[model samples]
Target: MRADAGAILRIDELTVSFRTDSGEVPAVRGVSFELAAGEALALVGESGSGKSTVALAALGLLGGTARVSGSIAIGDIAVVGAGERELQRVRGKLASMVFQEPATALDPLMRVGDQIAEVIRNHDDVSAAEAQARAVELLGHVGLPEPASRVRSFPFQLSGGQRQRVVIAMAIANRPKLLIADEPTTALDVTVQAEILDLLRRLAAENDMGVLLVTHNMGVVADFADRVAVMTDGRLVEEGPVDEVLLRPQHEYTRALLSAVPRLSVAERPAAAGAAGAAGPAAPAAPARERYVEASGVSVSFGRGVRAVHALRDVSLDVAAGETVGLVGESGSGKSTIARAVLGLIEPDSGSVRVFGEELRRARGRRLRQLRAGIGVVLQDPVASLDARLSVAECIAEPLLVHARGLGRAERRRRVAEALEAVRLPAAFMDRAPRELSGGQRQRVSLARALVLSPRLLVADEPTSALDVSVQRTVLDVITELQRELGFACIFVSHDLAVVQEFAQRVVVMRAGAVVETGPTAVTLSHPETEYTRRLLAAVPVPDPVVQRGRRLAAAGGAA
Candidate 1:
């Protein structure tokens, strides 16, 4: 592909490969694209599909092991084989990048303002005071609350959404002609994701900067980008206008991706034939029905005095046998706190938590261990949760070894193999390390490990948050299938209402450590009674451009 006169960033037959022990592994195979000024082009693909590799190659950020054979031109600078000095001259000044995870992107020790100021000073000749002032202005531009005070706060002191805004502020500090945002909203809440997308749109328009957005979220591409590029297996399968690609996708992969996205409009609550129990304001347990886990009037707080943070307040919840309950809330809203309280990971300041009819706080010694063995937990980040040194088999067998010591080695191995098969992973994967597996596979291993103990209850906390739409759908299907076959109760914690609507029978909305709303999934999402619930439902971006435009317009009118 040839670069047009108006193009600010261009890639021509960009092929990238990495030399590994097994030999050359091609990441991007002859991919070509262009981003013109004042336009937004999104690279949509799953993990290891070369979307992020293309962006990194454009910025000359690839490591020494990488081999590039094509042309990448960011204005007058050639990026494919440029030296460090030449690449440095182009980086940050002409092009910048906003990474996926803001927590790791920002320096923990330094104040946010200084970090932005440093970026500005690196690319321009300015005094420290002038740079500091510009940093504050940029922070304000990104819609950070109390920019003056927030500027002085460290990254650890701010919320996840606030930290992401600070990262954006730094990326745009030098006013680069091209900005590459890689999965910027993947880990954020629906409301915060919408806010960040709006901020990027405004900034791109105001500065007339070209944006290359790399993400697996088709909803975001539909709502934000002018054009779309679909990649699969290191190849660009399709590229066209957003509406054409999303509404009338030609490629099978593209169509599959669109289909995998959980839609709130089409989702229905689970049938009541085997519905477990109501979530909020728990009633007396029926004699025939079994309550797997229950937390009543639970209150938890961190620190003391003026520094105290009330994580939970009189929050009551219960999960019935063989039922799935979704817990939805924004960050720091105590969704995870409630999960921890139920797992006996943390003690509540007041009230009680009972699992299988045994109070968690009161259970001790052998009784406590026995009670804990019946509960399984799956965390958000599988990579962080799984040990790198351990093979897949060892990771899955760990629970059995701890909880079921009487089981012999052959019995444990058989259970591990069974668990892997349950999650749709082959026995061959048992020998592989966690690093060798994909994000979705790692999550499946996490599920297998959680299920190996044959627990009566499962707590999956944002297990699919970081996965691609198609992979996320597969994982959710695995969970549902396993739950149906095993008859285990579940508490699914996530901020994604669409996924919750599809997966959970009962829905609980939490805000400021209090249960704002709770009801059957369909009724609660489609006909919310509270403003907060309405806002959350509205914040979710649809995969259709026309619908998203209407939603944005309605939101703006409401704000006005």
Candidate 2:
């Protein structure tokens, strides 16, 4: 195959396989693509779909238990069979990668400036002071505030979005011919994600850099990529311009992926709109729900003096039984702080968190535990929250053992099996360890663990943020089914307004430890009264390329 004259990155028949315990498993099968200079291409698919494998293969990063074949080139440098010396010369100077998690990419021991400087020094012979100065300049270029002072801070000191910007600064420090970013915005809030994507796009255009973005988010793909390539299993199913693939997908797999994305409707939709028909009358009003929990003037602060951080200040919200309330905000906006207050995990400095009609502040020891027993919690990362040593049955049963000590072993097993069935998982998975399960399966186990006690309220914190689009839909469907089957009030805490639009009846928009806006989900999100809420909503990228393009033009015109 002939390489395009303007192409900065070129690939042909790239096949990658791993030597597993079972046998040789193909990860990428005869994949071929080209990325021209100053262009953005997205590789999208579910968890194990060859997209990430292809990215790693491009950088020759797949080393352990992996075999790679076929041609991979960056500019004039060959990557497929290059030696370590040759690969090193091509890596930082010609190509650089930005990983999904910024935390894993940066070193905690060293200052962020030093990290960027180290990369610069590797490619070019420069003085340490000069490199450090360049690092600060790069940070400022990436839109980080107080770049000079922030350069001295460690990765832990910076926020998630700031750390990502630092990583991007490092990737472009050497002015590489190609920049590969893999799920760069997966963990960010919608507004922050928009900023990061805008930064990447601007950097690519300004430097004429080729960006190969690997992500499962269709919205991000539409907003950032000029072209999109859909992968399934280990093969490319569809590849075309963003509009053709997203709006008019020819492949069944591509169509399914597009359909699975949760669409956020910004139009005024009645609560009972789904029931109205020409022949049938409107659906009956929902039954009146009792106020199960009320947080009155809740204020929570950590540390003291100048070091103290006010997480929640006079923030009050309530949830009725069988209703879902969303606590939506950006990072450091006190969303999780409010959730902990409801769970009786922390004591508020002032105000009261009443759960099941009992004030959490007044509740003590056995009473607090009793109140908490009625409230179940699901965290963001299942792998981190779950114990690797415990089997699925053991993980789910652990909660039951603590909450109901008198229950017999046989009864505990019965409850565990019941919870698993509710989440649509097979009984066979009960004996398997957490590592044996996929991401969606692990999250289901997390949900099952939360349900075993038959709680009246469930608090899920960014539960589906880490999942792929298709798997995210499946998990959400299970939640909807379970919520209907077991009528429990839900306090869903998330930065993703789109997910909130789908799951919650009411939404509370929080920022800087204060409640800026609150109303019905449809009305609040569709026509936000506050500018903060409107800004948050505007930052969310729709999956449609045509619509996204129009929004981009409108935003650009406004900026101009």
Candidate 3:
């Protein structure tokens, strides 16, 4: 149907292609949808399915080589071929976009309140002082704590959730008619994600704003959107209300996408043979296998005295050879800090971290180097972690040269090739630059580099959080396969509870720098002992519209 007077966003037969070196490549094809005022429409798909392209095209944000066809309208503004001046007027006034990564969306140097005020000042004929006050008001409106005090703080000072709130405040500073959110809560903690979704829902209702949510997360789509549009291979495969679409998907691609979503498989785990009357089953006893590393009462603090941040508080963790321990937590939950401690990167203020029976805090010089050489680190965002100047071969070989400098060039090349093969990548990728590959490919290269040294332990930090469900599955599969052959222990740190469930045999839940719960993945997630763990599990939105609706209804009833 064509957009009527009440429609806030309308797109008809919109097709977009880019002029790549390989010639015209279609990103979006014959997509049409209408979003009414105060209604949220989610465009859901995997990577390269053109969901983001559609959102960007609505604001004419595509680059120079992008060839656009058909039409896109935000309110009465024609966005298809609009001039920069017209686009600018429409940007903050008619429509605004909240990108996925809050860090890149915000200005690191300027105070967040000033940034919000700048957007307000740009569109409205208001004084700087007035705009600043409005920014503070926006901050409070977005549920940010102590808005008045935080207004003067730079983006760096705020937490991830706070930074996202600042971005939302800026997006709605002008009260735009349409809000385009592309993967707004990709890597956020479960509770933070729920808060952001509720905030967006509340803001939309209060301001009568329509939201165009672009994401691959089925759970987010289930919780936030009124309607769902599924895209595949640059085409609209399915479109319906959230209930109808997600509850009973009509398209196979939609079904696959929903199926690909990692869900919390909570089951009725029968109590142990002799422990029927206990409060709950205890964490599994330590196995008698080869223990690779053990962290005992590990406490870490940054800064000193009153201003100090306690990143880890007497946190203890252990991993045996051929084991994968998932470290799950929110931001500032000591998960990453503990992982770094395990890697010998951080000297703990108290307690001890012993890897291969050697104390990490005391290891120095050659000892430290030797210990580090046995530990491999894989961080999130391969694009930033990888060196742009180096080819895949060099990137993978650099570790070998650093640890085993006596190895001949031929042996180094063979090791790199074997690593690539283990990760199921072609040997030809060795000569390619980091930028010359896709997100998953870059990540594979990163994995190859981490395993090139054949380290006994791997600390993978949010390694698959940024990837699509399919790509994430592939990476996890590769890791599993390699772990079987290589027999390396892994400390996988992630805020992605679903992925933690999928990849790790054991789960360690952290909160406020303390380990709240530790047990098998199923036991910890399904029957968590701590209220914090229960809250964490409850905050996770399963990829089912019916279940989500029931949860919302139950929550509303409880609130009432």
Candidate 4:
């Protein structure tokens, strides 16, 4: 690829390899791209496809063990072989990075304001007070609430979306010529994801900064990127304008990727007979199906009187046998609280939780263990949930060893193998460690572990949040198939309305620790009664740029 004169960032024949104990592993193989001023170029692929490696190469952020070749130039600066001093001068001043997980990226000990100010002071010769003032202004500029008060807050005190805003504030503090955002919106909710994308677009336009977006979300690419580059196994197989690449892709891999994104239209919804009864507020009457798990008038509070936070307030929900109930809400909306309450992980201050007709809070030693055995849970982050040291077999058989005492080693191994097969993982994967598997494979192992107990109730909390679009579709299909075959009740919790609308028969919308709306998935999403629900629906970015622009314009008019 020829470098354009007007481009702010350009790469030619870039190759990167990591030195491992066995051998040198090639990650990026002669990939080339360019980003012009005020333009956005997206690198789209699954995990370990070398998209991130290329971005890291641009910033000269690769580690000592990495062997890099080819030319990477940010304007006149050479990045591939730049000295430490030269790289340091260019890093924050000429270019910046926004990482995926804000929780890990931001320092917990430092106040948000200080963190941003530190970045400013690192590159510019501004006084401490001046930098602090600029930090507060940046916070407000990024649309964070109460910039003055929030400036003193630590990362832990802020919500996921708020922390991401703070990270963006720090990244753009220097107004660099190039901005490299690596999966910046992967862990955020749909609404927050849209807001962050819009913020980046506006900031890039105002500063005429070039943006290199590394992501796996096709919808985000369609909405935000001017050009798209598709990567697979360290090679660039397809690259062109967004419409040409996404709508008329020539590569088979690109076509497969485009096919995997879940669509939210009514046509994709289940048949009317399978859908929950016509939309409206959930019927005051009880469901005829047998209730497998129930939480009534649950209330939970953290800390003392002055600092108390009401996480849940009189929230009531129930899951029937062989049914899937989706819990949808923004961060800190008490959706996870309901899951924890049903799991007996946290005791509610008021009201009761019942599982299999037995009160969870009152259940004692043996009874509690027996009750827990009947319930399975899949958390959002598979890596955190699975032990890194343990092999796949051990991870899956853990529940069996704990609950089923008489079950011998051979039986446990057989169960583990069966569970792995159930989730469409190879039996050979049992011997592999969690670290050796990909993100999608590890999540499959989590599902297998959750199912080894043959539980009657399953609670999956954002199981596909961090996965690529293709991987998410496969995982969701596996979950649906397993639920149908096993006949287990499920409480599916997620902020993605598209996935929820497809997977759940009924949907519950929560806000400020209260249930705002509940009804059939199709009805609730299509005709949201409350303004908050409408806002959330409007916030979802469709893959079609025209539709997204129209939605944004309609929302702006409504707000006006």
* TM-score of each model, paired residue for residue: 0.95, 0.95, 0.94, 0.95
Off by over 4 Å in 3: 1-6, 267-287
Local lDDT at 547 for model 3 = 73
- Where is the poorest 10-residue window by lDDT in model 1? 266-275
lDDT of each: 0.90, 0.89, 0.87, 0.89
- TM-score quality measure for candidate 1: 0.95
**Native-vs-model 1 lDDT?**
0.90
Model 2 clash tally, residue pairs: 0
The better candidate by lDDT, 2 or 3, is 2
**For model 3, what is the alpha-carbon lDDT of residue 354?**
92
10 residues in a row with least lDDT, candidate 2: 267-276
Clashing pairs in 2: none
RMSD (Cα, Å) of model 1: 4.1
For residues 1-560, could you state the per-residue lDDT of candidate 1 as single tens digits? 23335479989899999999999999999999888988999999899999999999999998999999989988767787678988887888889999999999998899999999999998899999999999989999999978988889999999888999999999889889999999999999998999999999999999999999999887788789999999988999999998899889999999999999988672122222112233334334444559988899999999999999999999999999998999998998899999999999999999999999989999999899999899998999999999999999999999888889999988888999999999999999989999999999999999999999888999999999999999999999999999999999999999988899899988999999999999888767766767788778778888888777776876698699
Query: Mind giving the per-residue lDDT tens digits that candidate 3 earns over 338-371?
Result: 9988887788999989998888877889888898
Tens digits of lDDT, candidate 4, 10-63: 899999999999999999999988889999999999988999999999998999
lDDT of 4 at 533: 76
